[model samples]
Target: MAAFARRKEQRLSRPDPSRKRALDARAAELVRLLNARERFCTASSCDGRVIVTDTDGTGIQKKNCTWLLVTHDPCVKDDVMTALEKATGDVVFKFEPFVLHVLCRELQDAQLLAVRSTHCLEVPLSHKGTLMVSEEYIEFLVHVANQKMEENIRRIDRFHKGLELALEAAVPADTLFPKGPEKSHSVYMHRRKRRTAQEQADPSRELEPQDDAESSLALFAEIML
Candidate 1:
């Protein structure tokens, strides 16, 4: 009865995959549109965000944050978690005590996959894809995920622009960060250069969002076409 009561409590409190799917089903059309857009990001989106903190010999630190926020469609998250669970017949998640925090069942390097939500610094086991998953489907998810990210970046860009404009107008930039995507993992950006007092942006510069945005969308359309 105690076990039963505990299970009931979890069922009430958590937003499991099934609940996510049910809600996602309501916006299947939007999902299809997003899947088309994500494939355009030349900047790798699937890997977890790896924020690099540089400590020069004397220990004065400089930080560079990579915004590889791979927002997910509910159905894709459900299917991937489901596949991982099915492939390994266990409740293999962080919440499960005794579940190895660093997994190596079907993977080699743990630095590849990341969960977006933790506030601490930790690396995770990354896997490319499971058996028999079609390229078309993965591409579909990539497109949608990229689209969602593009939309997110747009808001971020706008907020930054708003800040610049506000400074120009002497108005306080009270910009808001959207809460649409979950921060499951940190983007791992290889430190390409040391930060100077003048260098506040990321040291390793990837293609700007606008640079590859159109090409990515076009490439996805070509594939789908």
Candidate 2:
């Protein structure tokens, strides 16, 4: 129990090795940039990848998912495509969004960083995304998970703009810190704007309410009838 507590303390103190563990040049550059920020510590990230897998019924039990090539950058180059051609199975490129988890010193600090980091959904884009406040740490995740290459690039560009805005924003005097881990995994899901009862009603076909006096008179007339 004592050892576990000590490990937890060490984890909360700083980012783990995964933050700096980049598989390729692009991932390495992103890790470097995130680690350079004094107010931020990366939790996890991946550059992007193109995987080749064996789908044919030639392997053991006719099931195989062999990786011919796994790269950390965009697999758009001619040579990269050539490698795919040489693959023994189906060539698949699974475009992963650039994701970064950072610990912020305070709510204001997170707000500043969030505004700078481009996010996938509007929830993270807002200040509400900051979770698990502490005396010395707060957590903010930068995510842009798009499977489409063009959309992924666009979303990442937007996130980059958000980061720039945060850097240029004025800093707050007060700082907030994390106390305990806040479980908010649901924040990663894309939030849909729900239509209110009023919004759901067809405006063009809706019947206006009769005046109270008119309604009462109508009831009386019905009784007379």
Candidate 3:
């Protein structure tokens, strides 16, 4: 519909709001690829990260926590140790894998890429600046985090390839990308209206409820651990 296209354009034109104020290098290509298609646009994305944060006892409230170090690439033990020096409360080291939130033009478009799993590692490394684990254990944890980072990259690659294949099969190559903004908008609205009518006429077809921007259809591929 014209409304959805307009919203996508408005969102894309706005400034990036993530802490880094930019797309992660690892996710940049995939984001661009998806944006090129009329049926999908990325909402938010994180390629992966290794982080050290000083948190309260619960470690769940970010408002009371301080991020000491954050890196997208695999980090070494020295990096964690260096970040630990800045800790004033309980310190937690975390390895978070790639995550992407995509807004699809249709429910079926989202289903094409839907994947769900939950896996992330967080270890409480220090209690009030005092080491709670042995130096060797810290080294081992860093090694494991590094390995997870590597696996995260591979998963991203796999997801990219799979998406490419899915898009190719779902959309015609010539129409997958529009030539210009004006033409793209017109063509997209026309196709959307036609699809809407078709779905409405088909009594067996199930319709998804219209959602607000915050509840837009999303596709996610979480790390498997």
Candidate 4:
């Protein structure tokens, strides 16, 4: 328990290492809220983005690609056109939805958040350059991507609210820290059994008031995607 607390503190204290070198504005509030809670801390997050990349035919590999343009908010055609002008190889346009990784204080805390997980969408607009699609088609693709961005924002909002409710109902951190190995094992088993019962009772049940925010920190970390 002490180790977990120490790790969380260290991670939260470290400077951001992402390309932007800071929390995305759209997800910053949610990330801050999670870190403020005793039971959870955000490891990493993206608030969703529209990107145009120049790749060496190996697809979306970061090391093999150059990011021509990236925007956290909806992008305009002029911006995309300007980016495409710099592409020397195969170009791809993409819309990646919001993603967040969180660390939980306990197994039960992970499971509780896991139950609220939602599906994420990644939309690819172009496989090659402007050769395969018309100007009108590109405009249409941008419209669709923008729509997806809107939905992504809605999911983030839902997730924020659902987490607020969950944190309020969560057991206090002091109570969760065990005094000994035996007590820790007992608590783990009890939580496991209760989680099993809950799942059996209603397999499809999700966080109340909204069902769109469906992704778990545990699952995201395990997948490492």
Candidate 5:
């Protein structure tokens, strides 16, 4: 009886090469079909509990994973909580309150589909693309970014100078800036004129005064502001 059992075990352990080849061929075919498809993802809150699910190939339930790609079985984990981490070697979706719909091109453009309850919902990627971000608009954004950067530099320079002046006079930092209506350009210009009238003002600092060094510095400041 023992000899008969051993012989039976030996026959079962022998490799079945032809069957293995058939299985491999089937897997290759499935992979090709899956690759040609794209998976769409969406996030929404339903009721109190978040339901994260996936629908593939005409809105059928495909494999869910750490990644939510159009993939075969063998998911990331054996079970899932809020979201499943899929290691299907497909695109992974982070564990979140979201759902993904995997659809073929026949359904629509891959980007336009999102998962609804029964049917996969079509997210309209349609746009008034005519009012697009033109080259001019792109250039405008760059210009605005540069202008803001320049303004920031001017602010830093002004703050540094104000700090130095405050230290020299042994005054509080806040004293460098006049408050209320005195904050305006007209007020600053008025104060400058008064200082000039008092002669305590540096004649060199006068706006149009022929002091080469101060006039050049003032011109540079004006451009910066």
Candidate 6:
């Protein structure tokens, strides 16, 4: 556990490999800012992108989904359309939830940091995320979305600052680990669809190409202590 914390600290002091592969200029900046914080270390992030797949192509076109324009940076409609020009078939602009995962010192620290970020610091985190706690480490998955890509990066920067400031201050007494909002009843009531025989036979055909987005978890809310 101590070693992990030390690693996070070291990461904060150095350049991140993620920055070099950032989808855009803005995403690289967010990666730099969030990883630079003392309270956390980023795991992954993505600036949503437009994908062009040529249906005529064969066998899981590895390079088929050409990134017309990928960026963690802010986006404008004109720029998006321009990138689409290169696309051949099944043009899909997937604005996935801007996601960021980070490791924290402890569960209590994650709770305290979350509360402050929501109420005091005002990070525009998605109304959903995961706070995975363990004796060795604590992880936070921040998910948010916006039509304009830049806004999400700005929010991430604010979230990082919020976590840093919260760590410096004393923990609040009222809600040490504030509860998240209850899940909608409808979510539980809904039944999953069964795959057809063809899908079962060729499961790989049904599988969508993996994107950078993380899998969804139980929804969460901005906590206030």
lDDT string, candidate 5, 1-225, tens digits = 355345444533555443123223222322333333222111111111112233332333354322222211222222322232322222212211112223232222221222233211122111221222343543443344334434434443443343233223222212455666433333223443454575565555534432232222233233323
* lDDT (Cα, tens digit) per residue for candidate 2, span 40-83: 55555654443433344343423665444454443434433444
- Tens digits of per-residue lDDT for model 6 on 36-150? 6554566666544323122223334455444455544434445544544454544333444345556765454354434222211112111112212221221111112233334
- The residue ranges of model 5 lying beyond 4 angstroms of the native Cα positions read 1-132, 170-197, 200-225
Q: Determine which window of 10 residues in candidate 2 has minimal summed lDDT.
A: 186-195
Per-residue lDDT, model 5, residue 190, is 41
Quote the lDDT for 219 in model 1. Answer: 32
- lDDT per residue for candidate 3 within 32-89, as digits (tens), equals 9989987788999999999988987674748689999899998888888888888888
Residue-wise lDDT of candidate 1 within 1-225, one digit each (tens)? 355344444543555344123332323322232223311111111211112121222322222312222223223444433334333111111110000122211121122222122222222212222333454554464444444444443433333343233222221111222243422222211111221211446456565443343222223222211
Each candidate structure's TM-score, on Cα atoms with residue i matched to residue i, is 0.20, 0.38, 0.74, 0.73, 0.21, 0.41
Candidate 3 contains a number of clashing pairs equal to 0
Cα displacement (Å) at residue 16, model 6: 4.3
Candidate that scores best on TM-score: 3
Screening candidate 3 with a backbone cut-off below 3 angstroms (N, C-alpha, C), the clashing residue pairs are none
- How accurate locally is residue 165 in candidate 3, as Cα lDDT from 0 to 100? 51
Model 5 weakest lDDT span, ten residues long: 41-50
C-alpha local distance difference test of each model: 0.28, 0.38, 0.75, 0.69, 0.30, 0.40
Native-referenced Cα lDDT, model 5: 0.30
54 Cα displacement, candidate 6 (Å):
7.3
Worst lDDT window (10 residues) for model 4? 210-219
What C-alpha lDDT does candidate 2 achieve relative to the native structure? 0.38
Clashes of 4: 4
lDDT of 6: 0.40
Please give the distance, in angstroms, between residue 199's alpha carbon in candidate 1 and its true position after superposition: 43
